[model samples]
Target: MMYPPPESQSLKTLLPETPILLMGSGPVPVPQEVATASSIVISHLGETMKKIVARVQLMAQYVFQTKTTKIFGISGPSSAGMEMAIGSLLWPGRKVLVLNLGTFSARFAEMARGVGAEVKEILPQGLAPIYIEQVREAFEKDSFDVLTIVQGETSCGVKNIHLKEIVELAKSHGVLTIVDAVCTLSTMPLPMDEWGIDIVFVGGQKGLSAVPGISLIAISENTFQFISNRTQAMPHWCLDPRRAFKFWGLGEYHYTAPVTGILALHEGLRLICEEGLEARFERHLKCSSALQNSLEAMGFSLFTPAEFRLNSVVAINNLSNVNTKELISLLIKECHVEISGAFGLDIIRVGQMGEQSRFENIERVIRALAFGYGKFGHKLDLESGLKVLNISRDSGKK
Candidate 1:
């Protein structure tokens, strides 16, 4: 006369639990202040009437190290940022050479093609980082008007390290550089001006730790000139950067932006400056290193190579032993932690930026993983994990 213990008794039988950690896409959890900040007028003229737009632009200038040209809040998600930036600058019949390391880079190439540009994608030879030599060969053979790179290719755990060199090379050839820094900006130091990056886009969800509605696009003066000279009509209405500048600048916006998102992003930028960029980046490094070490110690292979691993998120190979869906469910229900599993890539991405970058929390996450797997009849060493986790946390700090 006994009853079943519970559906989740064996990890295999449990319903998927909500990830407690919530680190999957950008537009991550925003700080309370972002919501609390009173939104100003949404009218194009209203932008100049109040200090909100000015403050946001100033903060961006401080954080990104770029002189104020213009800033605008587009309505769509982060992808919209790329679209707006690319749509504004790419002209029909111009040749564009893309550095496609992952999904986002492929998206960039598609967007370029949509604008009627002749596109060529440079696919990496293997699972390694995109070698500088490969890029050099591509540049030597092709004369492209635009070059695109994803700074931290979240789809694959490859961070494009030769971005500076690529940007310089593009400049030498009179090719405009477009960068998707959606996952890299705040987690890593991005001195856009120094790097010679022409057009850069970042999402609020990733490094910014703000809500998803706000996407930032910063353009260099040269890129601005390129956009001004484009002959074809831009496909999207709200995505027109020149119209945005008119609104965010002295003129009224030809269209409206997401007013609330702009408010939140302003405060988010303030928080980042208050925290100090170097300290924030160091914290991110420490957390990522710890997570990588813990996973490796527990017999998991990292999808990202040692040299090109991104700071904000680490991708762990699923391997043969574990069912990723079951593992995520157990960790969520039993541990109240959230980690993201990549599609197409057999890996789970753990975030370590903003509020989630706590040492104890990272250690707790490892423990939960250990316990979660143990429940599934997998033998795990909880005792030895303690030693390995500590070593990882310690080494990552240095």
Candidate 2:
């Protein structure tokens, strides 16, 4: 008989008086299944922990759609996974080519440079998409061993749709590919094996809707062999993928694993499987589209262009008349909604990911935003935004 998950109070139950709407980049509301898993008590070095580790490994395989690649669950957030990928693949004398689309890609390049690797960046101007011709030109001018990129840059709400082409280009030139899919793992279409990505990592909290602290890294066989054959020792133990796989995969017990985090991720992936990958992707897209249409109707312009915009996160420009900080404070204080702050320019980021990606949630955010704008003496066209939402709903029905 299969045992059921433990019962626990949810975030809503704990905070009954104040209900918060989380539309930030990560740590979204968790589903009941994930919360239940997190509430369970399991030993760090026991049969239950072993089963949990195996379940997570299997879930990673399913989520990434890979059969032969090695998967490891690091006991940290997605940044740890990024470090592991870089440390495993890049060393001294190695050259890395990074496509700097946003803050995350810039971080990847910084990490590469910190590791004594020669780094060249293809920084796109503003929020524009990096064209293939630019990448071709860069590749022709410089010879690099690894190409690092982010599939979806959460900071600027940009998705590189031409990731497969970029990876194929790198592979053709004998260059390894490293992808950071922290924001687009389950919400977008990413076939690691089919697209020929060498190393990729994702966060458990962002798209998977699990608690933060688990980073799943999937390594291709060729990349695994390359890391295994490296003569130089990795600077840190956590940055070594072989050590992570040995401890997490083989149950050798490197350090204390995050049992609750692993179990929560397992349940989160199970829920994703139940929802069906294509269905989840469609839900995210529809919700994002509705949010964008509503925001545009309310006289707010999106930061990223339509072609390069991400379905998981939407960034909007701040009104010239209203103070951004004051607007954000009013939204949280009065409307009980929480969103991310501004980045380079005055832009607000809203995430529609995992359990938060629903029609009711999207509508709630729009209404709160409209109400907040009203408090600042600026009247927004809420009716027009609602009409757009209704139209989107009707179109979906048809």
Candidate 3:
């Protein structure tokens, strides 16, 4: 007899009865279309599954504006996407240059080292964007087989806007380029084919507004040939990109695919297409900008520079008068709102990814922050925050 799927409560379900706003780094609230798709029943390895996979791949192509690049779906989070991209290209004798900006970029370096590839990191100073001049200097000094960079550094809420130029520079040096677009995919400007990116990976949950457990990877023909030429076996069978391509490209199944996650991603991509990429990006920008303006008006400073701030996540420096940890706890306990604390900085992050990138949603978060700060012996200017929201709405932003 077949057993039913195991029953468990998700984090969202475990929260209190109050309506909680998820303005944190990842796993943003899914859109209604995605939630509906998640409830659909489907087999994991059948014709229906094949159709869903193809649809997801096509949607990825449309979202990334790629024509001929091969796309693959992995049955894991964006971390698995990173490993797949790195493990597919890295070998014992290869040199990998990693542009280190925040925690995730460091993880890329670690993955390269794990594969026994000689890794060199070009680290920026204090959460700043990795400059093209720095990358040029690194390239002048040494030769590299592959160069990896994160398009959006979620840990610090910074977006490296010089990616297209960087890709061209890497091409000039005959170095393969890889990008981690986990937080920027579908929410920012990332044209894989136009930029000539060799390999890039994005999370299904962050900007796609789908449920977690899926990673999408796009590969160019040149990168595919490099993987095809590898003679030695991969250290992990699950991380083999060629095998994954066969599984996604052909009907051969390597492992059980997450049917519900794929369905959610399909619906999320459908919504994105319906909304239009430019419109969706504008929505994120307006909402994030308004939130930042309100926060600044309330005497909180932004963590990232104005020129390099990401449109999806906002990092605010903690106030000296109020205990941040206590304020965060009180917000969750009393207001039922959740924001994220930075890994090694005195900052809190608010995300405006996908469906949560709305004026009212951001206004709610501001109100929650005001309430939490007030309860913690700090009087924030709630009227000023609300006024910003009103002006943003009246100005037809978002």
Instruction: Give the per-residue lDDT digits (tens) of candidate 3, residues 353-395.
Output: 9977888778878988989878767788889878987788779
Q: Rank the candidates by lDDT, best first.
A: 3, 2, 1
Which ranges of candidate 2 are over 4 A from the true structure? 1-17
Clashes of each: 6, 0, 0
Better structure of 2 and 3 per lDDT? 3
lDDT of 1 by residue, 1-398 (tens): 89867644666455454435665544355567875753554543563434777787778776676884755566677799999977887768788888998788899898998988899988887875566788788888878888888888887778888888888888888888888888887788878898888888887777877777678888777677767777788777788887777766654646665677777788889999898889888878877776777677776678878987876777877656778888887787778876777768778777766666667767777787778777776665656666776876666344
**Is 1 or 3 the stronger prediction by lDDT?**
3
- Which prediction has the highest TM-score against the true structure? 3
State the displacement of the C-alpha of residue 377, model 2, in Å, after optimal TM-score superposition: 1.9
How high is each candidate's TM-score? Answer: 0.88, 0.93, 0.94
Candidate 3 global CA lDDT score? 0.86
Which prediction has more favorable TM-score, 2 or 3? 3
Q: Which is better, 1 or 2, measured by TM-score?
A: 2
